[model samples]
Target: MSGRLQMALSSNMAGESRNLGNGHNTNAASPLKIFGHAKSKIRQVFKNIDEYVTESDRFLSGVPAEERIVDAMQIENVKAYRGKIRGIIDVLNRDHMKVAFFGRTSNGKSTVINAMLRDKILPSGIGHTTICFVCVEGTDEPEGYLLQEGSDDRKQIGDVQKLGSALSSTKASEDSMIRINWPKDKCNLLKDDVILVDSPGIDVHPNTDVWIDKFCMDADVFVLVSNAESTLMQTEKNFFHKVSERLSKPNIFILNNRWDASASEPEYAEQVKRQHLERDIDFLANELKVCSKTEAEDRVFFVSAKEALISRSPHTSTPTSVLAEGYQARLFEFADFERKFEECISKSAVKTKFEQHTVRGKSISSELMAVLDNVFERAIHMKAEKYSTRKEHADKLDYVDRQLDMMTKDIKSKIYEMTEEVERTVSSALNEEIRRLSLLVDEFDRPFLPDRVNMDNYKKGLHAYVEKSLGRNLQSRCSKALTITVEEESRQMTEKMVALLPEEQKQNTLNFLPRRDFEIAYKLDCRNLCADFHEDLEFRFSYGITALVNRFMGPKQASMILGRGFVQNIPRSMPMTPQTPTNEAHRTMGSDDNEVLLALLATFSSLYSRTTVGALAVTGLVAKAAGWRILALSGAIYGLLYLYERLLWTNKAKERKFKHQYVKYASSKLKLIVDLTGANCSHQVQQELSTTFTQLCQQVDLSKADLQEEIKKLNKEIGKLEEIGAQSKSLRNKASYIDSELNSFILTYLKQKD
Candidate 1:
């Protein structure tokens, strides 16, 4: 952001940019043609690496190839790095720069590209026309290619004008791209170092925002077109506000286009133009954060893209065609805008791209050097041990194999031991807690034993209360204990696996075998144990309680049990017909005297039922008249009737005996509930124990390949290893020397740029 745009449309002068900190200058003075010097160094580095790669491949191609000793995949990664280095060199030679045109709909972005190219390539119309990003690159020849995203092949095109239909349409389609191979001389701006892109309007399509940020992130310069007939609209400001997150403000150019449209009101054209220009500059500096008012003025340009585009006429010496009077003067602004764009972008393009390529090259060089150094270290390790005879080599192999088998056995034992320890810890805790739960059953039975209560309601209420109590205790004691035990035991297993064998022996086996890292095999699978424990405990308790409740109570009775409504009558589902006496007590109680007394009581109860008070008064008078004997008989009669009604019993059973049955039945039911709860908790413990044991078996696996077959190969390969190891060490030293030199040269070249 500086006032470097002085004398635009006048001369091809190179404006100086502010010096970047860290002793680097944007306008550095170099006697060696910057591109020529860079290209020479780049070619030299590529040749050196290619030679090193060829030598490395030759080493890998020998008998008992490097693939058998080390991972073959590593060589492929190095090859990929080499391919990337060549790609950077190609890009450096082409030096293609990006310049993107962005603004709201119909603000004349395509028109700007058309005028710059001096050709009507982009489709511009009343509504949105250029719907996707059209990247018009400068090719060595006058040709074009269309490549839709995901398409493997590019189709040849004869004209840039044909790109519009393929890019933008209402029909659903994948992303489309157009690469115009414009002859370098088609435009002065695209002559040496830049490619221009005409993007869709800022807010026209939802996907436009994504493609611009993701696909066009590499664009070096951005030109925002505004209608100069008026000041910057709020829509344009809001659009740029979102755009500013991805693009820097210093790289933006504010073009106040259509400045010539004011010729209709020619009375005070200069004043109106000045007013619009000043207003736009202020907005750019304040809202867009364009550094300062001076910088904004330097960047803003007043231009008529339509006039500039149409001014070209085949008949005239001066470039002007069908346009309003005074349009040519307005066209001067467009000329000035082009000059400013070159000053802003073209001047910096070479230096910016050079720095990028240098940094990328340095990184690749450092990575390649590191890889070679690692390979050299591996070779040195192999060369350290040597055998004068085949018998000595066989002895060493036997000793190594025996040590690996011992190490594997110890690891398996450690895993089993951990599983047993955790299982014991939980099982012991579960038993102690279950016995304690049994002691609470007596208190639970109190609700179910209540007289004058609804059997249904009491059963339901007690079931919920007891279930909640048991659930809390199990979660706090059983689940918490199990979780803590499993986690600690798991941690121990992990530690043991991490230090499973002597570090060197494990490493030797890893270098030979496919199992590389020990820690990778020891992943803990107890991530959801705590959650599973809580869910299982709750679900099992609820299931057990439902079964216990169904055995003791009916629907209606159970509902009223908790309401303190005791058994009022026998269950309605049972048969109500009276049976012939079978027991001794019932037969004696139902003899002829008892039958006569029951009939007498039934008749008196029927007569007195409707008129109880009157009947009582008459009985009292009769007792007084007949004397103490008649009164005593009447009192005994009334006592027997009252006892039968209250107890809902025949003459065979007493109320005291019936109350005892309630207590006995309720206690039995409470015992059953406690038993079921304990059983469920025990099952859960077993489940969690099994899970932990299985996880340990998986994590601390001791499985290995049969070494007998490998031992046979070992005899054949051991004799040749010593000879190969000696040659490998010698070649590795040469590779190291070349890598070190490449790193040194890369560092020096980048340091000069810094």
Candidate 2:
């Protein structure tokens, strides 16, 4: 076992010491101590950023799926950044200044580390002892312990013997690491957050790249332990070259150990020392390009680890006065290497380790801020669009309401006018039908015989015929006006309503509208109303004057004028002799008959021209009842004359008078109910048109209600987005503040002051 590197007695007394590590005080203005403080501050910054990322992730997750501006993949990417930040935080928490040693076998790499530690912490011999990487760091515990890679169990080391035994018994790979945590009381370098890594000889390992990547990637300084008797070897130089390739401008120190062996070759010692020094300087400044020549000169040192260990050990009995040649100079050179290494490792560690983390923190904050800004802008745009859409819906609703009101007023006025027009049309048509009643009655071709049954049936047929003719004329004329007006108004209303409805609902609403193809009926009960009419079938003597005189002289004075109660019960099958009457009445009746005949002829000239007026000559009963020749001949002659005269008078006077009175009665009744029928027709039109328009109004109301509901929902969403935007903005400001603080701290501590 080797001892520690000895310090000058006066150098030790220059500063007050504490119990932290190797009696080093916290007040010491050391580079490594400043690096520790920088690491802690940078770690805190990373933690702050990590917290912000977590809050951002929660904010993104809480947003509704449709409203979320950031997609799921983007949120996942943010979460990945959080994971990376957390990994960085873990790294920063355990961060320390590290120095790794690389050299060939039996070059005293372990002895050099042991010398610096002021104790035999690592096994060193002529044979290969370190099979793998061994990292030694300081612990607060009084006793030291060993922790292997991938193992949670701790192997306690009370002394060097136990440490060596525990390291030998472990079956580990070349790339694996065994961590040896020693007490801070034993070593000042370890106490000040320095981790010294010892590796297998570079000669024994071909995997230089992997070795460097795993152990030397974060190493702040590298020490090349070489034989002072020999020049720098190819293997030692190649390892450092690869390290320089991996790490940008790595801090490297050259320690030429066992320089005391040079005492045997004193004559060539000065030349060899100069050769080693120049080559080492060339390797660092020229070949590796890691440092300048002036800087490399201070890095190169020749020392004997054995002598320095002996001088610094408290267990050794040998004194410095009896030591080998140039022992004091070697010890002083070893001490110089330590002092320079302290400064180099501290500065390199601060720049290499904490600077990169600070940059990443700033980048994360900037990216998240940009993402938040995009989200805020998107929310604002969405709110603006919603407002615009709501205004459009509200405007449309107002337009529909105004159009509906105007349509309702116009349609009502049109319906009232149409009702009046229909009533007038029906009245005019009825009056024209009554005036042509004789012609209309003549058109009834049903048999009218002298029997009571035939006369009664004939009266019924005539009543139906006249009633149907007048009703058909009125309906044909008036229905056109009602149908056209109602249909046109309904179509206009339907079109207006369809425009107000949504496109998807328009087809359904059209199907829901009522069809206006119903038939209009006018109830004119002609048969029941004309039941009192009597057909005058009695034989009359006078063919013209006497019959007209009896027709004008009705039972009552008012009956003739009013055309009511004019006809009395006459014998259906009996013939009556002509009654001789006053000449004055005959003259009066003749004057009236002449006027009536003229009017009937003017109205029904074409109707009579189209008819064949047949006359009965004789009856079989009159001829057969008297079998004697003269009697039969006389009776037949009288019957034929009476029948002929009666037929002529019936056609020209009795029938015409009967038709005139019936026409007057029917016309009066139909006229009395014309207003009612017109009213009914108008009401039907109004009801159909009003119902369709009302349903359309209902559809418009429903559409407006739906639009209002959507507007309300949009308003709520906008409010929520506004709140979220405010929160995101606040979080962005906090992130920016933390990022700025981290940059400031990095600039303050990472600068090289010593």
Candidate 3:
């Protein structure tokens, strides 16, 4: 073989004092072990916070809409907090120390990761070998497996060649990643929970932002593997700049790989190494400002990854080739790089990974406490307001009750007094109408042609006519006055009662009784009340003379004695009889013609004393001279008296006596029923006014009942709000305690230095 081929062939023979299995030296004394403990505690704390958020959301959602202090939007914000807390819990569960490598193509980026593992796990070549991001982490399984993004099936990684071929043959975007799970027992770095990620060349992919967001966001440290023969490229530097923008003070390391190429130029080996160191340190310390210059010196390294990888192989041979001159020294440098990287990654990952979680946990707890506190305070305020409003409603209900009670008494008293007044008015009017009963009987033009056979029917007609006329007259006089008085009082009472109702109910017409015209019906019927009435139709001397005078002197002179002024005219005709006694007796008779007829009959006895003797002597002399007989004259007189007495006098006496008896009977009957008719009218008025008052009372009572029910509901709501306030206060206190514990315990541990 040639000398270059022999150098490559003899690289497996190199061995050193250090073992590759203890690459990170992650024992009990290691910082990574302490960080892992802290990480576990942080995950538990986040899990508790996640549960708190979920419980808070459930509690807030169950509150009644009327009783809720927080609106819908704020409650939704709490639910959003639940989602954020769950996201934090998921991140905490999968947390690991990650280190991503970035560089131009063929800068030995994959070779650097393989050397760290002390095995060629990642594909490395002279061109762009890494087609997509490849992540290598530890798994507890005995067999290794691979998982590509967007798929769940595991592919067995039997060997590096097969894994490399699988990665090379895959059609994946530059941003997509392949997860490689190697047995943790084989690599100390993987055993310490270190995940190494190798990316496609920075110069090959333009989507560095996507790559950083998708894969590098959780990375604890970034390694920039550069070719030792060239200067640091801008494409490689820009990737870190973008990374620093997303992460605060990201941990970065510079690896000057392929340093063995400088062996051919021995004269400038020191100069080239010095130049690469200065430029890389300036890029990190001055340009990025991620760390100071002293910190940057420890972060940069010059090593040969190929030589380091070959030196770690399980072989024992001494190679003496030209290219293998400084292999042992390069292997030492790689070991030193691993030691420093372990320390840096352990401390940095603890702060970068868990620090953010702690900070977010503190913020979420504080915000939750604030939300609970706000809810508690709002509940307290609402509870107080409800109590005050309930008190107002209760007071209003009591006031209305009192007003209704007093108004009921006042209205009832007014109705009683008005009913009495109606009774009195009806009684007085009925008495006045009864006193005019004779004129009413006279006005009956219903053709009462009385005879012996039709006497009963005539009496019935007269009785009905008097009853109807008296009832109509009494109703006309009494109804208007009583109606006016009762309506005015009822209207006033109605207005007072309506005022006691609720504001909304006051205008509702259906809630109250409608107004109607007030009236008391008068239905007096005296059809069969009188049964002992008798008319005097026997032959009387007075009726015979009155009929004879009417027949001889014409009907006009007789009507003067029988008409409405007959009693006054009778006193003038009987001048010789004591006038004062006769007028006094006539006045006592009162609308009856019996006393006048008796006086006239007594006066007719005197006509036969002195005046009739002289008239008979002259009449006897005239009859002898006219050749007429005394018997003929006597027969003519007898015939005239018989005709007048049987025909006109008997009928007139029967008709007049019938009227007089009917008037007397009707007057007595009307007087007897006056109190009863007045009482009925009064009772009717009482019923109307009482019913209106009763309805008004019902309306007031209904309003009072409704107000009382509302007060009860308000009291219930106040109690509910009180319970809600107490629970919210307790939750706020608990959340505040958790926030303090997170700040004092978890944050202090995450921020501690290695």
Candidate 4:
């Protein structure tokens, strides 16, 4: 051990001392003061020494030191002192320990555990000894309970026999965990110290494999029990591989069970035992050989659970000697078993302490070195690299800036032209078609009205003539005159309007116009004309006109117009007025004339309305199409240009950032090293150099860990953003469909009108 370690241990043995300051009273030089003060001071000193040794031991054992020094003169004294101090401290703290037992199925695993406990809590047989994982701790109750996953509720295992039934009903597999707490009355057996976890048998059922694996991983010390009959089976090898990967520190305990079977041929048995031990050691290095419950030490005894329970009743007389021998043999195994168990526990504890010490030392050393090399040295190198890369990126960004500007100008100009072109095409086509139809209809002249006296004045003269010649027929005579004049005018207008439209254009226009529009326009024209005359006079005149016109020209005009046909035909007869009483036998003849006049006006209004509506619809369609086309074109151009710029320039920004961070870290480490060592140093400065080197290593490790964490977070965020972007695309596609539908409707309407 190093001088420091020896001195610390010796000081702890000396004892400790204490001091209490005095204010006034001394009791006149009392004899008690001299001894009391000295004893107190010694005790205090010892206490301080004990603390120092404990702390120093922990530090040395946990950390790895430099294996070789550059100067041979320094190596023997310095490194040896450190190593000896570390080893001594490590041994001192390993008295208390924990061990975890594990192995494959039918490997005498439970047998060995039962031997250690000196009781049979676990079932022993062929298929599987342990169905569920059980953690056995020294307690007051020999009770077992089941803990459920994701729940805090515990169910008591009141009966082991009923366990299988309960689990079967619930469909829970055999691998389910069962925790058995030893009764407090029996706590003395275990000394209330060690915690034994009897894990579910490995290779029991395929379904239970996961639980077995989990138990092995969580175990602190590994006890691998293989049957003496078969040492290291294929299943056992597979289990070992898994344990080796997960556990950093593992101790192996091998049990050679069923020694009674070999009693008849001791020599052959010994040879077989030796062979088995060698094979097991090769498989799992550093394994302890343990005998079965029947042959082991007195403290580590086991009983055949089935026989013990069955033979408890006094009905049959079985030899007490025979049972006593069996029980004695079981108890004898306990002594050796307990000793081995204690040793295994102590060694495992020591190993754990050693591991912890080494880990701490290496951690500190690595951190210092990493900070100096990666953080400082790399930082400076990266900074120079970043400068060059940033310059190149800047040039690329400038190019993109120019491209974006040019793209904007080009897009705007193209959009304007597209809008103007669509608008002009739709408007000019629709208007020209409408105007041509209108002019054709206007070309025909109204019929020339012959020179005739005012209708009322003529009517009076005619009445006088009629009364003088034929007194009773004057009304009839007046009617005849009116009829002839009306007929003549009606014939003229019909012929003129019919000739206005070309045969083909007229048919196409009539087919295209809606029926409702025709009805509305024709009604308006008739209403205007009919309202101009006195009601009674207009009825007579209108009736006479309709009848004469229908007889002379209605057939030819109707046939020609109907050939181009609207949805419904105009009726020759007028409808009866709803206001007329059903009981009336006589009615005025003028009612017929009123009906006829209304029908003619309604027809003209309908046709005119159809033509006007058609024109408006065409104009609206053309304007909307032009607007949308411009917008769509503009959007497309903008999107493409934006993507182009991002692809070319955005990546450069990320690369530059990465480089900058690397440079910053490296520069910081380099600066720290220079600051710690001063600008100029002699070659012989060994102690100072070693201290600086150690500090540098620790810093570098810490910095590297920080950078790794930062990078991990960045990658995670990038993945999340990409997922969100994918979801956005789906929504955008649905929205685009709706927009297209609306645009299509507008375009169709416009084209139809044109």
Candidate 5:
């Protein structure tokens, strides 16, 4: 820590406290002292906020228990609020601060970091440089490095020479970011806390804005580096001005680098420094509205980063201290600026951050409560009312039962018709797709294993080409065909189901039909059918691509090849069972995310090559006995593989024999997906209809006694929550009071004019 900060911290007088209805008198305290007091009180108040979030997260793990109980948005709101509250917990636990450096090209941002670290850790240069963001975190060790970028795994580097090459854009992977675990004892400013982020220059690169966007969520303080040679320009002002919309202007620091250059003529240096500082003060005061000119004067820092670096370098003859030897004039300027920078960061309020998080939590919680109340009024109330008038709604429920029966029959009929249509469409499209891919394969007339080039080089290029070719073939011919078939079938299925639905009938007496229950059940059935159809559709798509790749490439070659694009992306396993306890209609959910598709693909791709090699080796004796010729078609994907089983499995001399094999293979996989998918869809539909229809009948069968008993349970839970709310109201009142104190502290201390 710097001398001034340490002195200020030591001078922070601990005050006597007496609680006066959650609003203590903090009259004699300075702003920083008030911050310490208020933060403690605020943390205590947020404990209740924590409990509220924990309880809600547990109760609403995957809420509504049944979809009939609440709408999708209501369930979604609960999860959203739970996430926001958890975010508040994260904010409250943050014991460290993060600072970022942003400026135009060659503004000495990296040099500033190097000077601060007291080591040449970052690469500093002129012109447009620094292609990626580098985040340096304080560490206890000498030095450790994490080199991260692109799809490559993070490489840990301890060697200083290796780290140098990793930092360069051309030498390193694209989007490489260096995470240096810099020793805390080496740097005074970032000793026990600050995580400094250095970004690429703002206006030079084409992707400068995109690279900067990644830091928007993390940056707490921005040190805007400006050259001492120039005044604050429009682009620099505009950059800070745009950022001030999101980040508070008061937290910004103006760092003027290369101050030693201006000091060549000592007489002119003071005038030059004042001119730059004055312009910057005006920009921050008027344009950014951060502060008035007088308040902003001390915020602009002019420093000689080069001089500081020279003083710190091991080869330098000058002593380490700025005042020692002949270095007083050159390096002392950097030391004074560094002290002020440390002071500015040390004074930033802890509560100013938590206040935003608290507000976010409160907003989310309020929205969730509103959603819950609305759901209670609509669904829960109607269920209770329907129970009271059960005797009158008997005929209405009977009519609903008949309609459900008709809906089941119509759905079964439509599904079969659609499957037949899909079969017919797939065969024609599949044949054409096979022809298209086969032509491309035939055109590649190179030796299966090239005689000239090495095997490793041939294997890598060939695998990429095949994966690319299959990807293009899948998108253009295979998946598009499946997409079209699914759309037509789905449209026809919806039309038939809608035609089968019964119209609502008027009742003579004052009665309420279980309309909500029936609608929920019907939608659930519709949802299940669509889910099954889509899963089966994707499975068929994957199977078709596998078959196409198998036919032209041969099963031996196809098994060894990795399929990366389109239909070759093996479809995710159909979630026939509910993953969550609350959502009993798990089978009723359809996901386009293909949640586990990539993981399965990665596993299968690796295993595909190994397993085929193993299987072919085991069957080598059989191929030798049958005198099987090596297939020349599979040179493109993976290097080479041989399948001896094919020698006896298909007789190319007989057309009927070849046709039987293709027909058998295609029919078996398609039928397997259809059978499994249809069974899951049909079973879920029956189970869901039985469960939901029983619920509707029970609601229609409820006696007044049953209704009264449920109301008692409902009111009891409500009363408990209301009691908790009262306590919450008191704590929030305390939070509000302390928040007011913090605002007062800011106004009373920070904003006071000189």
Candidate 6:
């Protein structure tokens, strides 16, 4: 056989060779026949090799393979070429990988990255410095700018000056998101194959959490930086737990910074470091320790980012000297960084294999596939059953909605009634208070002045007395003018009270109390009659009668004296009456005077009795109105509760729909995988099938994994829906119970009144 054919056949012997040694020797055959047989076998081998090479070349057409090495020496290189080709094919078809750096505020995360890159591009401080995610990749130009959301336009930042000013400015709004790009020339550390992302610092500020959550979800590798002083704090632990659960890819690297500071006492620091590493391994399973590049002693480089930037500029080389002194330390750090980087890259390759197994074919072994299929079928059956449960929940929610609708209407009606009742009560109370005030004033005047005088004259005398008293007091106190102007001040206090009601209540009584003339009046009447008699032994007795009439009426004035301290004292002066002398003969003729005295007392008693009764009636009406106000407030609360219930129901419905879609998509994907892998066929053709079948099987496994994931998601959604459904039912039942109790109380109150 030719050399090429021999090599191809020998290389494929393990995978494709078949034995034909039984009674197949042909040494006795003719020389021409032997040559012909060998030629035919060689042709067959060449055809196979040509086909395999063509297929491989087609698959890896655009993939870069310069970095890939098939063998260490020339002897095994030919034999290993096919295997190398297969590996390349697998890698070329795999998904792109990503890594993220995240941690608590002031953890020196940025500094560690600077140490890795041997330069600083990210901001670091005790307070919040990083505000948004910064994606860094190898580039040729040193450029940085901000990318606003919903726009393709980028705002160019000329230098660190703009970036620093933007970060430090008080006017920086929420819309400010920045992307910094620096060239390898500016910072040699940035030249690397891996993409590095510096996410907004987590747990530093409330606003940054949102950005971290979104960025971390898509991360393939998460490098968590924890400070030596507070390694694995509650927030850090919680964050790691969440990340592990959400992003199941196993590429996680934990770096403990500020180890030097923590290691002040060598033994203690070493113990603390070991303890931290053990704790992290327990929690995360992958962790590392590194001294913070920003603060290190004894061959430790304290990177001054400002100095590094200055060195890069053409104006001066001052920063160059500072960096040169620490070059040896930086070199050591870079060596360590290179080792870590290589380790991470190797782990990424393994992860790629895992991903390929998941997506390219059915990764589950035959026994595992059978078990999983059984489990999946059972899950499908469970989901079918859940349809009924979901329907039941939906029906319950619909019933609740209907009940809420009825409740809302009932509450609205009660509110209207309560509002009207409150208005009536307030009006009655105000009128009663006004009437009480008027009667008190009338009683006061009756005792002080029995005869009616011109109102103008009376007011003039009252004003003169008040002015003289006020003038004296003011003169004693200060040198200010005593301006006493007693103009009648009338207020529609009932109208003001009504205005305080809710807008809905105000609208309900629009007709009764129009906006332009919204006032209610209370009427009060006062009549005074006085009689005086005097008896003397020497003269006939004489009696004189004086009568005064006044009327006071206006809107309720309770508010006018609401906060004022008055009506605590009653005047004691008696009314003035004309006097007459009495004699022995006059004593016998005193019947007329006696009759006058009796009439005057009867009038006063009647007036007082009527006024007291009116005040009591008004008080009772106001109390009833207050009861209505309470009912209205309760109705408003019920309305708000109903709205909340509806929102919850809507969210539950959305979750159900999402779960259904996820299930359907997963099922179809699994079916396609099973068909491609030919997992349910006879075993006769299995041997003839190439690794293509295995690869396809791995793909099927990925689809099944996706299906399992969907199922898990569905289960989670179902649990949430169940929780909300139960909560809603409980709330509704409680509300109904409360309504029943309130109704019972109202019934009792009304019956008592009856």
Using TM-score as the measure, which candidate wins?
2
Error of 4 at 593 (Å): 99
Question: For residue 72, what is the lDDT in candidate 2?
Answer: 82
Provide the lDDT at 531 for model 1: 16
**Each candidate: how many clashes?**
22, 1, 0, 66, 0, 19
Query: What is the Cα-based lDDT of residue 163 in candidate 5?
Result: 39
lDDT of each: 0.54, 0.73, 0.75, 0.40, 0.52, 0.40
Worst 10 residues of 6 by lDDT: 481-490
Q: For residues 699-720, could you state the per-residue lDDT of candidate 6 as single tens digits? A: 3344345445655555554553
User: What pairs collide in candidate 2?
Assistant: 4-118
Model 3 misplaced regions, further than 4 Å: 1-28, 61-63, 68-74, 125-128, 158-175, 203-218, 229-250, 260-269, 287-289, 311-329, 354-356, 374-726, 745-754
Each candidate structure's TM-score, on Cα atoms with residue i matched to residue i, is: 0.42, 0.50, 0.48, 0.30, 0.40, 0.30
- Relative to the true structure, candidate 3 reaches a TM of 0.48
TM-score of 2: 0.50
Q: Which segments of candidate 4 are over 4 A away from where they belong?
A: 1-98, 140-151, 157-171, 188-190, 206-213, 264-267, 286-320, 323-334, 350-754
What candidate 1 gets wrong by more than 4 Å, as runs, is 1-6, 9-80, 83-95, 125-128, 142-179, 188-193, 206-208, 248-250, 262-284, 290-294, 310-332, 346-357, 367-754
User: Which residues of candidate 2, in runs, are more than 4 Å off?
Assistant: 1-27, 68-74, 158-175, 205-210, 245-248, 261-272, 313-322, 325-328, 377-722, 749-754
Candidate 5 lands at a TM-score of 0.40
Instruction: Give the 10-residue window scoring lowest on summed lDDT in candidate 2.
Output: 16-25
- On lDDT, the stronger of 2 and 5 is 2
Colliding pairs, model 3: none
Task: Using TM-score as the measure, name the better of candidate 1 and candidate 3.
Answer: 3
